[model samples]
Target: MRKNSSTTFVFIVLFLFAALIFVFRMQLVGISGMITNFSRPLQAGLFSVFNHPSNETNKKFQQVVDTLVSQAQMNQLKSDNNALRDQFATANIEPSQLLPSRIIGLPQFLPGISLPEQLILDQGTNQGVQKGMPVIIKNVLIGEITKVESATSLVTLISSPNFLFTAQTQNTNTLGIVKGEGADKVVLVNVELSDTLKIGDIVVTKGDKNLTGKGLPPGLVVGKISAINKSPSALYQSAAIQNPIDITKVSEVFIMLK
Candidate 1:
């Protein structure tokens, strides 16, 4: 009986070994495709688990680099501005006396008839800005402060139809009234026909001799004459003057206190 039991166990072990050999042969005969198909999802899962965090880390490092570059540029601008202020002091022109301000508000056109003809500044009476104060950018006259509140002011652009200033031509020293003609254009009217009023003549502010020193500084560029309209019958010649300032691009300005 013991011998019979031992024989049955040997037969069972031999049958299992034969089944394992058959499976190995099937894998060698192109049935390995099934094994590969079973492993595809596991391979993708391992890739996602390991690579996703690395990609996120790379993106975060790029953002940090961008922020550092922007900060460096801002620091450079501040340094250059300080140097400019010191240079102005050397010229005996008290730049410290001038109030530097930035444009804060721009014209926002709505669906209706509302249009903004002026700019809003961040400085106002609280910052020593007053009405009628000349607003300039880099020594060029662009406009004047028309209204001053406690913390803000309104600037009437030189392109406004109601704005006017006394201007003189550089070559001829001929005086004329520079008046805004709307649409970023000005006209030098009342120029005598005999004067050397020609196209391309540069115009500048003609200072006044009033007691309160209310006049704009002389030599502040107004614009250059682009066209000259001369008529034999008319007593005075009018010329179209091009506005030097592109108001849309203005970001910073200064108000002359003295």
Candidate 2:
């Protein structure tokens, strides 16, 4: 009877060992799938902490984009506001007298020279923008319209080497032709050597008319004289004129009707 009991105990131990082996094999085959089912509620939380597209990361990226956009918008608003103020202050001119237009395009290089000379406007013949009309930005003369289309027009910037306009000194009241020297520099020519054009003297349009009878009005600020070059051997004195406004930064302009 004792021998029989020992044999039964050995069988029982063998059966338990076999069961343990089976359980281990099942876990090895489907361990990953079992864990996913068990932790489904926490899966999203784990991914957000470890992945690149987390909520925190998205918020940070959005903030950076918003800052950049806000800065750009603020700059544009300032420019527009300044333009409106200039229109109101200029010669007490009514808004109906001035035609507002945006620069649609700018040339890569000026014609006949490698400089920024030309720009295109959104106005055309339909808007009464004719060739040779003066283009001003904030009461300052920038260029003249050279070409006209049905819906667009081309402008020649005063800084171009090919551009020339009649200007006069404010303090001395001297008349001279302002000629572009490339690189945003201009030279006042044909002034008498004895004329007193001092540094910091303001220059403005002379309102001289062309054969077409259209001309820029007097008292429109052009630039300021920065240097004077007088030669005893030369017939007239010349000076370097500094433009007040940066042409590259200009976006909108006014086409004077008169």
Backbone Cα, N, C clashes tallied per candidate: 0, 0
- Tens digits of per-residue lDDT, candidate 1, 160-191, equal 88688888876667899999866677889998
Least lDDT summed over 10 consecutive residues: which range in candidate 1?
A: 88-97
Q: How far does residue 163 in candidate 2 sit from its true spot (Å)?
A: 1.9
Q: Model 2 Cα displacement at 243 (Å)?
A: 0.6
lDDT of candidate 2 over 1-258, digit per residue (tens): 999999999988998877887877544325544443344335334433433344665556446434533443444355457768887532332343678986656556543244567777767776787888888865677788887765567888888886877888766678899998777788899999888888977787877777878776765667779999999999999999877665444556788866
Sequence-dependent TM-score of model 2: 0.60
Give candidates' CA RMSD values in order.
29.8, 27.4
Which parts of model 2 have CA positions greater than 4 angstroms off? 1-96, 109-115
Clashing residue pairs in candidate 1 (N, C-alpha, C atoms within 3 angstroms): none
**What is candidate 2's local distance difference test score?**
0.70
lDDT score at residue 1, model 1, on the 0-100 scale: 100
